[model samples]
Target: MKANLIRLGVDIGGTFTDVVLEKNGSSFSTKVLTTYAAPENAIIQGMHQVCAKAEIEPGAIDQIIHGTTLATNALIERRGAKTALITTEGFRDVIEMRTESRFEQYDLNLNLPEPLLPRQMRFTVKGRVDANGNVLVEIDKSEVETVVDQIAEAGFESVAVGLIHSYLNPAHEQLVRDVLAKKLPDVNVSISSEVSPQMREYERFNTVVANAYIKPLMASYLGRLEDRLCEEGVRCRIFLMHSGGGIISIQNAADFPVRLVESGPAGGAVFAAHIAARHKLDKVLSFDMGGTTAKICLIKNQTPKTSRVFEVARTYRFKKGSGMPISIPVIDMVEIGAGGGSLAYVDTMRQIRVGPESAGSEPGPACYGRGGERPGVTDADLVLGKLDPKNFAGGSITLHGEKSKSALMAHVGQALEMDPVEAAFGVAEVVDENMANAARVHAVENGEDLSEYSMIAFGGAAPLHAGRLCEKLGIERLLVPPGAGVGSAIGFLRAPFSFEANRSVYMKLSDFDSQKVKTLLCDLKREAAGFVRTCDEFSEILSEFKVYMRYSGQGWEIPVELTEEQAMNPDAVAFQVRFEDDYTKLFGRPVAGMDVEITVWSVNATTPSEKVEPVAATDGADTLVVNGARQLYDPATAKFVDAQVVPRDEMEEGQRTAGPAVITEEETTIIVPASRNAIRQPDGCIDVVTKE
Candidate 1:
């Protein structure tokens, strides 16, 4: 690919649709209010504006990489198509009976998240495959035909097939897929063996049901988007970002939308990982605050940490194990509904609370003047003088500060008997505290310490809150990288074309079958390589092998790395050594004499990533003076202080600006308190270091 080949990346968020165009090593980005009815409208409108600014034709675009929250939003909002779940006879209620644990033990009135497929829609067939992949009970072909007829009569849009132990032997699943195509050619079908070929029936079944539940909707939307782009003279290939911080073909995405659930956050992690590599920061915490959510991810050694299973739409205020569990490779991060467009109001106990609820871009925060009466985090930001009235979103939409103030006053201020400014601070503090609490809990749960990690801030609203968040978390430094406004969109350009193939087959290290393992790994590698070959132009592909291992009695498994040579040879000692190494890194030690068994084997075939170098420092301790000063409330001091204001672009690398100061940019502003001193890094990042 030539440097002049225009590469466009579009990310659809809850509040804004971000577009980034890269050409000849330079990038141009813009944000527009997302169009809820037709998301492609926002993409076209934003693409037009950015292309006009760059003076390029749409036909010149060589590739378009996209990431979106639409699939996730639909799953969370319960707006996907009516779906049916078909499983083994005894596992009809697996999704509903999640984990058998209470997220909030003391809260007696807690409501559980509803299953995506209701009990009435969940049907089962008489099929059995033993744990060793032996066919104990054969599937009745006539029964499958009868089930298909019943599904057609029931007016279902999609179907999920999840037989017990199907991950080990997909013969029954493949038969169902073949029958599905012959019976109902248009309806989409997803199988657990294909969607999530891992053990644990609950997670695997839920993942397949989720895929089937959202298949029709995602397929229709993606088809329409592709058609619309073709109509707009864009002949480039479209790549979709996956939950694992990589790019895969559109066909793969459509076939398995479960892998796309965390795609948006994965992009943010990729963005932060790139910045960390450029700045040579070994420990970094990526903070991304969009319109509807805030995400916190940890990066080390220039790579984001990845997890095999994560929950979605937690019920008890984002509590773990209280939501739908999906088994797929995803970048590990903590996400909360604390963003600019998150709703703010008085709760049932007469306490002020911010979302979990969001007034999205359609009828955005009251400050946007888009027919919304609910006060939001953005409204409070405007009320507190953090946002520029005229230059918001580059002046795309004029903000009404008074309207925001009035809405906040009527909804929050009068109830608390405080003035609008104090109330505004309250809203901001609550949201900030919510984010801090989430980050703290996530770090502690993962056995990580945040004090030692630097912060990488992005998204439209992250920079505004990053400085303050660091102050609260006792974090010493922060990096607000270039293209901060649309960081995730730009990150799409850096993703690699890859796919991971996983399968479940219980085999103890003591009973290791080298021949069987070699054959299984070879088949999975070919399957994964076939997917990557569709989107990459490479002569060779690299393979990564891993196994999910755990003690015999343990309920869950931990992933451990396996070498190509080791995967072909049977050696219990080597397996134990690798498992112990990984276990010690995570939990500080491994239990002795515990028999470890491999539950799932995963192989990822990938194309190589482009080389990225660290940005060099331009050394000089220059002082950038403020244009003016303003009285702003500082939470650490718990009082109002005079803060200096400086434009972010005007301050060059190596410039020092002391707090209390406000660093303003086109997309967001950074507020530094008197307790912190900011030094501009060589890579144009503001490293806000603590002062003694």
Candidate 2:
């Protein structure tokens, strides 16, 4: 980014729409309640607010980067456009009949989610393409035209073409698309080969269906946003953050909105990775808790881990396989329905249970006084003295403590036969424990230890509970960076312009063909780099190569990275050695006799990463910062303690404060538990470490 160029980063979350404006190494940020009906309204409002703070006109903005949750929300709510799917005759049930394995093994009355398109909506054509890219059965033009006529008569807003083995050979799918375009020119179309060019009929078909489903919704929103921004005199090239922790041109984002499903969380991960680089931390845990959900990601060596697949809208208690799987490059993380607005209730087992449901910003938490009666995490925090009733959102939205107390008592206290404070404690503990368990599971899955990783907490609600969470996870240190509440928006600015191109070609190490491998890799590089060029025509682009490999009998594969040299000159022996090294690190050892096979190959082309200046730890003498004290609840001691209230802006460098304190800022507040102490670092980061 140019020092003098003004950049705007916007993140539309489930609850809040965050905006950040940056120029000449300075930034201004604001948080506004998300406008569900017109999410762009919030963005415009927040943009003006930040521009006012920065003392600049909206027209002065040089660029805009954005990420939104509309795609994920549309799929989760099942409220996308009326979509129809066309597939090979026999594979019509591929989406309906998901993988055989049940997410929960012992539940006898388990129920799988229904397919996105019902049987009536999913039409089949007589077409077949084998796994070897052979055209076994070609579709008759009249038959495709017949199917298209029915789709047009049914008034589908979007149509998805997903034939069997479309990833291997897209001719049939493309033919279907051509027929649809001729019949229904106005209707949107998405093909599996373009949305997700990979194997697995179920995943590929579902991915295309999802893209088509959300196509109209996202396209309309982006178009409206651009028009409105231009109308407001904001003349800037708009970019979008993709789920792979990078930026892409708006044109690319509009074509494949599924890539934006995890965009907001991906930006948060990028923000944490930037922090990790500045501090030179090898291992860091990124925790982001907003109003509707909480996300946890592991950052190692200043980069967030990447994955080719992840689930969205998990239907059963955030179970891995219970949600729609969209096969696209993304930052790997575990997100659960545990956030500020996550509602709470007493379960049938006489235990307090937190959310997979949220109150959202329309009604918000009970304390928001917007007609919501249920007690959520925000209500519990208010009852527990973790959030100030009068100072929330910089006093823009005043909270009602009595409303929270009443709601908590009615929903949880009476059922549990406990007081409001006790009920609030139960809810808070459950929320914290749920997030900790998720973090632990994610860490164990990746062969990591929580105790060895430092925590970087952000988002509007994370810092309030991060202290207690660190205690539970046995983490010793936490860093709350500036602009923590709007971390994702800031991350959007930090991300590079990039794209990942993926293809599935079944091959075994025993049949090593260097020439074929070289061609495939080169083609992938060109495809991925071409997308990046659309974002920045002149910036130097770097290519990253990876292969997903598994043993012959295994159902899944792990990603193994390869250098350009290694990819260009493929060797069977070298492939085995690299696969085994990564495999041994993950599973302790690799099988000696099993043959190794590659399922998917990927190439990511990205702009060169920005250089980072290491943060010099503040070594000046520590001075305690305390202006007043309030009765803040101490979860560890199960009692109320007089905690100091320190204004963050007034705190000087090297200033230190013991636990039982609250560091107050405009966008958020950091709660320092009694068991730990905090110090203001040279870079304006609040470092929270355990008391000696």
Candidate 3:
């Protein structure tokens, strides 16, 4: 760590922009509503607030690490620049066709997501590259010129070039980019080979298109943010958090904005991992609930699970293959629109249905007193006495209880023939069950049991329902760390400067090419390390290797970790043994006499994470006192009870508070349910456990 260095971390979410300033070891944080027109405005306001709290000037900041949902929102809302896709001849519809696998097999009326580029926007060139990196048909310059003319006439701001088998050879794609650049010098071009050098044309093509779609927007926003920060006298290097839970330079982020799709949620997972390391927990689930979405990630051995492919804007709530797939490294998690601002209403079945729709920052919830008339989860929370209307968001915005009641009664209560409080209970129950179902599905898909894992809750809205969620999931322990409301921002500070580079190269174990494998691994390491070097010049960059392996006829592959030495010196026997071991772990047993094939190889270059001292376990809890009391709804008893309300700042290590209680903080509040007790652990974490 640099001595006396001041680091600033900002996370722009759907509803709020969180800013955290760390000087020496102490930290100051603040949350402000996100400005949809210009996100940097919120960041600037939040920075000023945190700086004032820290009693420092903006110029004193040494570094700024940022994570945002802008790129994701742009793609989901279709607000990106006018973009076009160029692909190999006869393959223009690959993105729309989408592998022929239906997520809803029984439903004949299943609706697939539309491609990012329509048929008119997707153009094809006469060029071919074989799977073995052989050029079957050379590029035609005149044909490229014709496409370039059409693109120029269409006023496209960005173009995506994705030819068949371009992952193996980029010659054709490069030619198209070169020709297009020569003709349209200002347009941004993204090639599949450079953006996602992996197999599967549909995924690779869609990934590049997504990258191209958001490139101009992210680049302009980042440039504007840089200029504004400079005007505020903050002279420091800026980095962005990617979806893989690592930090990359602003230029790299701008170049491949698709990598930032889950950046904010990835930070929350990183924060949970850090807390897990401190507590020495091997299995933990990260629960992050912000204003617009709730994310659940499984953390094992103090590291969040990572995946190569991630889907965004899922049309079907919990079903896979119903969204736009982006083949980029990302922290694996399940996200649902079950947040504080998620709107709630009664459906035709006379049942309460919570969102996939959010009010966001413009109207926020009914309690925000904005123009929104629909009741949201936050409004329900306020009506249930789980949130204080006067002290919400640090008193920056006073919530209106009357507005919340009116909205709930009009939208949900009247339909269900219940009062506002009863309607609020129904809404809260539906949202909580929605989140719980998502978590359960995620765990079941991963073949894990929720009872064995501890839950780490963060983000602004997580604590308010974490205890109840744990009760629903049969989870015994829950940890809410310090700065839980701005956890993602703090995670931006803790993340390492790193990057992962991967490529697809098929090789069977029986016909292992040692030299070729070594070469591929070496190239991947160099590529990953090169990006990391841009962020940290002197820190040691550690390399981690993984290969995707599966049976010869399997559709998908499983990741098998490889040591640096194993990757450098390929041993067929050792590789097979590791593959079988991992395969057995996932499927209970490996297939006998079946040849194993490797499809993709990956190398992650990262700086070593900061070390954390483990917290010593305690045997007995100390006595506690009730600071105050408030009427809180108890779902189990279906009534309101006077619960102890305590300020978080006043609690010390080893202090204990019995449930039904509410632990209040400036950023958020933790509601200890009637069945659980809250204890302040040694590491400044509130440990909520079921009462015996």
Candidate with maximal lDDT? 3
Encode model 1's per-residue lDDT on 405-491: one tens digit a residue: 888999999999988888888999999999999989988877889999999999999988888899889898888887888989988
**What order do you get sorting by lDDT, best first?**
3, 2, 1
Q: Against the true structure, candidate 2 has what lDDT?
A: 0.92
- TM-scores, in order shown? 0.97, 0.99, 0.99
lDDT of 3: 0.94
Task: State the lDDT of candidate 3 residue by residue for 440-497, as single tens digits.
Answer: 9999989899999999999999999999999999999999999999999999999999
- Sorted on TM-score, best first, the list reads 3, 2, 1
For model 2, the stretches where C-alpha displacement exceeds 4 angstroms are none
Model 2 agreement with the true structure over 304-415: per-residue lDDT tens digits: 9999889988898999899998999999999999999999999999899999899999889999999999999999998888788888987788999999999999999999
User: lDDT (0-100) at residue 351 of candidate 1?
Assistant: 86
Enumerate residue pairs that collide in model 1: none
Separate clash counts for every candidate: 0, 0, 0
lDDT of 1 at 653: 79
